[model samples]
Target: MSAAERVPGQFTLVLHSHLPWLINHGRWPVGEEWLYQSWAHCYLPLQRILRRLADDGYTDQLSLGITPVLAAQLDDPAAVAGMYEWLADWQLRAMEAAIDDDPDRRASGHREYRAAAAALDDFAQHWQHGGSPAIRDLLSTSVMELLGGPLAHPFQPLLDPRLREFSLHEGLADAQLRWGTRPSGIWAPECAYTPGMESLYRDAGVSHFMVDGPTLHGDTALGRPVADSDVVAFGRDLTVSYRVWSPKSGYPGHGAYRDFHTYDHQTGFKPFRVTGKSVPPAAKKPYDPTLVDAAIDTHVDDFVACIRQRLIDESARLGRDALVVAAFDTELFGHWWHEGPIWLERVLRRLPEAGITVGTLATARRDGYVGDPVELADSSWGSGKDWRVWEGPQVAHLVQLNREVTDTALDSLDKRLPAHGSADPGADPRDLTADQILRETLMTVQSDWPFMVSKDTAAGYAQDRAYKHAHATREICTASDAGRDARAASLAAGWRRADNLFGALDARRLPTRDWSEK
Candidate 1:
């Protein structure tokens, strides 16, 4: 297994960037404010980092998945308003903190806070197009792979067939709207999968969707097809993903990095480190960006070298070329791990230098690499790389909600769907009203809403996003059920104005299965 017979050392790096639907909604926990913070800290910073790389001679290929829910919030006017307000409040909080501490330290905090606030404002304005255009241009040129998912980021397999179909339809359609190209790949909201999910992706025109590595049954290290569907399921290489961020130990646990949880509420700035998760906040070390940057350089080198070795070894062991995939949440960078963006840049830089080719699932599938389809184990990229997080005790309420809401919503739509496949008349208020109600209802059952709620970390934003989506679904259904054509249309239109993510969901695609109890 020499380099000559190892195919092209090509691999795909997929970063899933998503947030629940948070628009003119809540302030703390899960609300519009949370959206702004992530935008300011993660999304905006990440875009800038990529922009810098693109502006340079680097054509290092990367794939990004921005869910329809996140896209909607980023592009919403009310969401922008909430972001601006949050920034302003953050500045005010910093000012107050500056005056209460030692003069020198207080002044330094004030300066840093002001600078952060200004950067946030500028990033917001620069991203007026929801940062969609820049991403689209990158995809168009092939330096970046643009990926999309459902209207509300639902786990299709867990959803009722009807709702699942509608969500995928709308989600794929939304990708077309943002990237100016229909994506052939999908980043399942949680990398959650079941055997029948491949059928749904095929119906939505997706060529591939990600799955956890262990999900691919047996010793097949690369991607394998589920059932007989044309869609390919690429498994995440946990060995690689865990290099930077893992459930137990990763770079984020480094003692020099800024603490995510113990921020100074008075100043709205984090100036400490998690010396030990078990240690009290007062015992943690002072956060130092410079020290963390040094650490990142070391870790980045180790990861790149490790990848190079893995590629070499796998190509040797398999007696054929191999592909390795590393998938992660895009927000982990600037959002959860403050130095994440810096680490990413360092790693990307090292990849090309180390002779590794960056490609997306689109290119991977296109390159004729998929072979020997196998039965995939039902799994997710969660705790234990399985569905425990989703089906765990902490989140049973969410599971119940997912089952009930979807069941109820589908029943409401099914009883009223145009009989015998009657064509929807655009001019008839009742027909238009029904279509919109069914669409919203279908989008609501997306599993992402509740999974986020159950996590408790992003609990605030998750609950609000779920409730808001749920409310929209109910309102539309309630109006339609009562045959209030004009009222239903009005409410439907209002929802569209607030949350028009994708226009592709049709009531006809709702799953027609006997597992209504699921």
Candidate 2:
């Protein structure tokens, strides 16, 4: 630690890695294909970068939140098999492009071929069993702090308190089961929070969580304890974070970087650089890796300078040491922005050199970077920094469906099962039926469907998923209610083959409550 590298404040890079349960759903555009793409482009490459840094003796590089549902998919046998096939196909496509008549296409093909081959080799070495081994190794080596979230990534603000607690408990437990240690902090789904959510955090043993800056009224210079709880809330410093990627502008939009939207239909690869925002895909230049080095170098320097300046400015503004947390979706790195991993590595390396302290959310809290408690209102990191994205008029039906399914699930489970923690842990047929019902019910209320519908991105798929899960929950519950135990068990077994996840989830954990009080 050099004196020149000392800063008055700390900066934490938080990346929330999440995706809904996609296996046994659809395949292309929005399902298993989505999982395989992210696995190759984002998860594989991202882990390799962290492993390299860890091998070089870097620890606490960032906070990574892998939601329970996403982890389930990553560790699933079917997904692992599908990912290997996808990588093989990717290599074949690169080979086909390498033989193309167009010079540019051939060059791009060669580059992709090497990339695909390397990815396949890496998967075979580190991820053949499942993502858990690699992820577990990362945690064990202290490469990054793992932040857990609720099962299925439900939008907590709009969810019932009972289900929210169950999800959080099981979600953290799932992380422990996979990684051998439970996470004390979480990247709350969407960074969504209501006034009383902190108490739930306290109850779940969560020490901290992230939220958007506006949710804290932009006084994001320090972490604040929500309400009177010791559980702290860290706000994303938009000024520093959005400088890399935002709704309209970012380094990825630079003409020299590979464009995310322009794809070679034949090869299923993005083959063009972002020549200009107005340029059509046909007019865009072929992607050239040679141009990316300079872009990454320039952007990394700019980002390092920005973080240095922000730390200095924030410390002076508050007349005390400060904190700047920059959070983003983990997929935004290699998946959305081709050179993002390169830029991220450079930024993380340079910030410490530039006298800007870099650490995780856990480090910030443990080091006493917390401020006074705040009574946070209903909020999320979505459009308008509120809950409209999940509860808006456009998705009114979903909001209603979430409520109805949650209530129905509780009622049905309570009538059949003993009180919480009282049921036997054996694999009884009725217990399996209850588990499937609760699983589908949880899937129905996941926040992704409404978000996709509201954003008009894959709205059809989103609606279909929500309805499918809801209908499954209702059908199973109907059989159980009508004393058709055999039918209920059969449906549950069928669903389990497809939706099997969260082996720790049991209906016994969901406490039976008296509805008359409500």
Candidate 3:
């Protein structure tokens, strides 16, 4: 289709990819497994799909938000090496399963074996060096605009202003180091927002970020710049996003799609289809790749038509060009929903063919999709579309823990480190100490802990991680306050090695006073 004949409405698909600091933390059913599974299934496959589209001259096809914490993991030498080993183990497991006595299990094993082998091969070719190179290659194509968020993916609204500002700056810097440019937009952790956060975003050099549709009072068809700021807040259109995956209904719930929760006890692989919501894992039918392939096509067509009709209806209602943004976690594609990557590839390719103008959030902003400025309320994409999930009774303890740790860390750092000029110029001892404090504080502030605890999914692990980091921060601060320079330095270095993200973190960037107040 000619440029002049293109549709008036724009569709922007935003995938917010994030995981808390899990490296060197734990493995099975939680930490490292989560990272490797996402890496092998989501990141690698999505990269292949986007790279393919970019090679074919698709520009700004989507907006991918890779949180700085996840970026650090992707680029970590330890993580890359660990993932390589994990993939090898996965292949071996598949090989063993392929020889199972049960024909159904054997067939499933073989299918898994092929997938493992292919993922291993792709990892060797594109990801052997580290994720930085792979991601840099994608950025070079400009087919997808990268969106970055604060270090550790903190709930920004509840975070201390000093730490919040520091994390945001450091996070953006991390992205720049890896990709050669800083992202102008961020997927605010959990799509959570508080009033006046936009001013902080503006100061951080961010031009836009995402919030839930209800955060914009449910009129999410157009991007709205925050009051008195150029930072545009793009609201995710639930009507479209939920059509793919939601609590009650979505394509992933189809009987043909791989079941996310049910897994074979012996091999630990999901071997059955989502036969029914009430179906037992043992009773559900075996997964068939062919059936899923057929289902993908059906869902693809359904989604395309949904978008087309949405654009047509929205454009008519607005009497002008409209924008519909569907944002989701990147893990939903290949991790939670096994057929997500294929579905993504088909959707990207089919959207333009159907005359819908697919674009990145950046492109939408550039094309004047910014509607009238408005004051947004305090909101999040969580339950009740508010901050209750993060700060409610279920997780109030975790919230208090975060607040205490953040306050203690900041207060100690301010006292010890002071500012650059105020402190001794020649290799201040407090720099390393301050760095450690911030690192532990950031990790403790990660939104994952509260979310996991609140949802009762891996609650123990989440609580443990949160307290572990908090304890580390407190211990380091205590050592420093006692003037035990040797002990403090030793403890700080040890914790640094453990957390080991944001190596470029500068404690001096942490303001002594709240910059937001100024």
TM-score of each: 0.87, 0.97, 0.96
Better of 1 and 3 by TM-score: 3
Q: Candidate 1 or 2, higher TM-score?
A: 2
lDDT of 3 by residue, 54-135 (tens): 8999999999999988988988999999999999999999999999999888998999999999999999999988888998
The regions of model 2 sitting more than 4 angstroms off are 1-5, 420-430
- lDDT leader: 3
lDDT of 3: 0.90
List per-prediction Cα lDDT, in the order shown: 0.71, 0.89, 0.90
Q: Which digits, one per residue and each the tens of the lDDT, describe model 2 over residues 338-357?
A: 88988888888888788878
Per-residue alpha-carbon lDDT of model 1 for 1-518, expressed as tens digits? 34443334467788899876656455665466667778878877777777777778565467788888787777666666666666677677667767875653475477667756766667555765556765665655556777788777676666766666667776777777776888888888788887777877887788888887777642434566668877888878878888878768888887777778886655567778777778788787666655776788888888888788877776677776678888888889888998888888888877866777666787777776577777776787776767777767776766676676666566666667544332343322344555566655555566665566556667655555556666777777777778776887798888877665445545554444444454
Ranking by TM-score: 2, 3, 1
Clashing pairs for predicted structure model 2, backbone only: none
